[model samples]
Structures are given as C-alpha cells and as structure tokens.
Target: MGSKQSKDKRTKEQKQLTPEAVQVTHSNQGPRTRSRHLSLVLLGVVEVPPHVWELLELQRLNLSQNCLSTLPPALGQLEHIVVLNLSGNRLTCLPKEIGRLRNLKILFANMNALTAVPEELSLCGKLEVLSLSHNLLEELPVSLNDLAFLRKLNLGSNRIAHIPLCVFSMKCLDFLHVGSNRLENIAETIQYLQNLQILIVEYNNIHALPKTLCSVTALELLNVDHNCIQALPDDLYKLSRLRKIAMHPMDTGLHIIHNPLARPLPQMLDAGLDALFRYLKDKDGNIY
Candidate 1:
C-alpha cells in the first residue's frame, strides 16, 4: 500500500510539469528575456495576454489601423515606451494610467472617437509631437500647458472654437494647426510664440488680423484664407522671413508704401487696386 501511494504522488507531479503549465509561468524568466522590441501590424482587436506586460523594455508601439476600442491599463507598465501610435481606432478616451509613460515623446491619437483628453497626459514631460485631429474634442485640458517640451500640435477638423491663452506660453512650439473649426478670434497671446513658423487657421470665422501677430519673427507660412477677414495689418508686410501669405481681399484697397531702392512692384501688385482685390477674392474662394 505504501509503494502504491508513492507512485501516485509522482504521477501528479508529472501532470503539473506539462507544456501548458510551463507556458503559464513563462519559464520564470526575468524581464530582460522577454522581447524588448515589439510591433503588431494589422492585428484586429488584439487581446493582450497578461504575460506580455513582462516585456517592459519596449520603446515603440504601432497599433495603427486596428479595431481596438481601448488600450489595456497594463500598457502603462512599460516605462520605456517612447512612441505610441493609436490612430485609426475607435477609442473614446485614453486610460489615465497612460500618464505613467514618462518617456513617451510622440503620440498619434488621430481619427478616433475621443471627446476629451485626459489631463493626466500632461505628466508625459518629454512629449514632443501630438496629433489629436479628426476627433470629437470640444475642449482641451488645461493641464496641456504643462508640457514644456512640446513642439508640434495638430487639432484640425474638430469643434474647438477657442484656444486657451495658456497654450501661447509653450515657448518651444513651432507648428500649430487649428483649421476647419469654429474659431472667431486670433488670440493676442499668440504673439508670444517667438519660434512659431507655420500657422494654419483657414476655413474658420475669423474676421480680422491681430496686430500682435507681427511679433512672430520666424513665421514663414501663414494660411488664413476662407475666413471673413477684410483687412491686413500693415505690420504683416514687415515679416522679413514670410514667403507665403493667403488671405481674402480687404474691404478697403491695397496701398503700396513707397521704397526708393525697391524695383517697380510685380505686375500682380501693380495691377490697379481694384484688379488686385478681384484677384484675391477669386483666389480665396478657389483655394479654400
């Protein structure tokens, strides 16, 4: 009888050592043994296994063009993720735990159903490029001003009507796109963005230019066409680096300031003021 009991105990131990059991434990490997670099393409609604979080050294995650409705909170366990792309999904909001990714630099959350951004995202101190266009956002989180290192921000094609004055405080921002919205004012605070180069606010309801905008010395391209604007501040001509300016014709007329050394104005400008107004009105209606 004692010999029979010993044999039964051995058989039970063998059953626990099966391949399925080994897979559950993942071989008791350290975090370093798991894949540090992971890319999932065309994965449809991937159900992340609990064990996958052990790969905590991940740096980039591209889950674009998937059917994911939300991200697992376990993703925040990856402390090293730098770039995250969740575009072309149906996510309505981001998990607050996402704030744990302190090293994240680039985030693409465009083309989603997001109605609002979590204020916790401001915790990502290193974020540089953020694209939240094509969403249903009505307002931005006030905490967004805390992102000191942000450089590019795209909020096109949303319901946004006003940009908080605090955003103008981001000294590093260079490219800003807020077109195709309901905006009616050019915040005077925008003049504080000394490094701003490209500003696109076309297809809105703005009716005039802010004199303070001339302070942006680095501006190169300014597209404000398709708005109700009827005048251009004389200061606009002083932007030495500006190459392209798109606007509708002023209700008044274009007057050339006399310059002794400058050659005769280009034919486009020399065209009588009446002709110039007609040209601009036609261009604005076609381009925007």
Candidate 2:
C-alpha cells in the first residue's frame, strides 16, 4: 500500500513540473528592440498572449511539455526565429503561418499529437534539421523536397509505409531516421543520397534491400535491424566507408540473428563481422 502511495505521489510531482507558464527573456527595462536576441520558454502553457508576437527579435522558442492544444497564428510574427522546439506538446496541427519564419534553421515538433504537417513548411528554404518523430504522420508533404540545405531528418515511429521519392532528391542529407515504421520496401533511388552518413530503418516490415543501397558509398552506419530482410546484396562489402552495421544490444548488434537470410550469412555471423564481410566478398561461394 505504501508503494502505491509513493507511485501516486511521483505522478503528481511529474504533473506539477510542467506548470502552465510562458516566460520570455529580452535585453532591457525599455521598449523591445529588434537588435535583442529573445528567447521564450513556455512549459505547460495552455495559452499564449497576443503581445508575445510583438517580440520580432525572438530567435529561440521552446514550448516543450506543454498542454497547448493549438498555437496562436501570431507565432509567425517572429520572423527572426531560428530554432523552434515544440516537443512533448498536445498540438494536433500547426498553423500554416509557420512558413513565414523564413530565417528558421532548426524545427523540432517531435512527440506531439500531430496528424499532418503544413505543406507551407517547405517554404523555409533555410531549414537544416526537421524532426517530426513519434507522431501520427502517415505520409510527408512533398514540398519538403525543396529544402536543398536540409541535413538531418527524423521521422521515426510514425506510420510511413514507403519512403518518399523526393527524400532521395536531397543531396545534402547526412542523417535519415525512419525507424519503427510500417515500411515494406526501400527504393534503389536511395543511392542519390551521396552524402548520407547514417541510415536507420529498424523495426519495419522490409523484406529486401536494393543492390543500389550498397552504392551509397559514403554510409558510415547502416541499421536495417528488426526487419524481414531475407538477404543482403553481395556488393554491400564494397562500401569501405561503413563503420558499423546493426551495432547495438537492443538490435542484437552486427550479427544478423533475427533474420531468415541464407546459410553462410547465419554461420558467418556466428563467427563474427570479419567472417560475415569475408563471406560477402567471396566471388565463387554460394550461401544458399
């Protein structure tokens, strides 16, 4: 009985930690100036004041762990905002006006109730990182392909079944995380991600990998764990840049154990990564 009381008390404390408050910081005791770099942190804030938009100089805004069901459209008034974090919020949708933040570089809207993202978000041509993980998103807005400078994109734990072809068009993308989704197939077009360093597509229904995937010679980390993949392309060993493959305890690491791959792969994995790669490198051997 005492343990149950303790658990309840902890829950209450956790609830109290996210107070419905909005705090903004700026330079001085005088009128707001555009030269100041303002930051606002609105934790558990259920509503925002309209006057908050008057701070045109706001550069960073953190509204994480909030109870906000919606945001005031006036949020777009902060044209100079560079980083906007709206994680751990109750937001089901974001205002289209969000596209007005042209100078925005990083946007984090993960862990929300978002069902769809505004297509206008692609208008932020300068965006570098966009994370929309842990949402109800089934597909992405195609306009996002226009983000030429985008480097990192995290859409893990969503309902995405197919990787958008537009995603392969981003030449500068370095990190792509699409884990824990419903993906069935990855296109050979993935080779277009010439600059890709890390690719995570774990916990999915993928049954096969394209030989073109091995063509992404720049890949440093490739994680295709927890999928239904029956075989890996033999040329995969040609990627000398690869440093880790399925390396994690949760994933059971470099040994492709939880798969139905042909014989030598399972046997080679039992011997170690060196043996596995060597098996792929052999020209005259058959694993079947």
Put down candidate 1 lDDT per residue, 1-288, tens digits, no spaces. Answer: 999998997676445333232221122576555433444435554454455466666677666777777778887898888888888888899988889999999999998989988888989999999999889887888888888998999988889899755478778999888878889989888888989887778778887779788778787666675677655554554455653323332321122222121222234445553444345445446432
Steric clash pairs (candidate 2): none
Candidate 1 accuracy as lDDT: 0.71
- Our tally of clashes for model 2 stands at 0
* Model 2 per-residue lDDT tens digits across residues 1-288: 999998997676445333222334545754553333433344446775555577676777776776778987898899988888888888899999999999999999999889999888988999999999999889888888898999999999998999866688788999899988999989889999999888888789989889898888887777777888888888777677664345563442242436677766777766666666777878426443
TM-score, candidate number 1 = 0.72
Off by over 4 Å in 2: 1-42, 244-246, 249-257, 284-288
**Clashing pairs in model 1, backbone N/Cα/C closer than 3 A:** none
What value does the lDDT take at residue 203 in candidate 2? 89
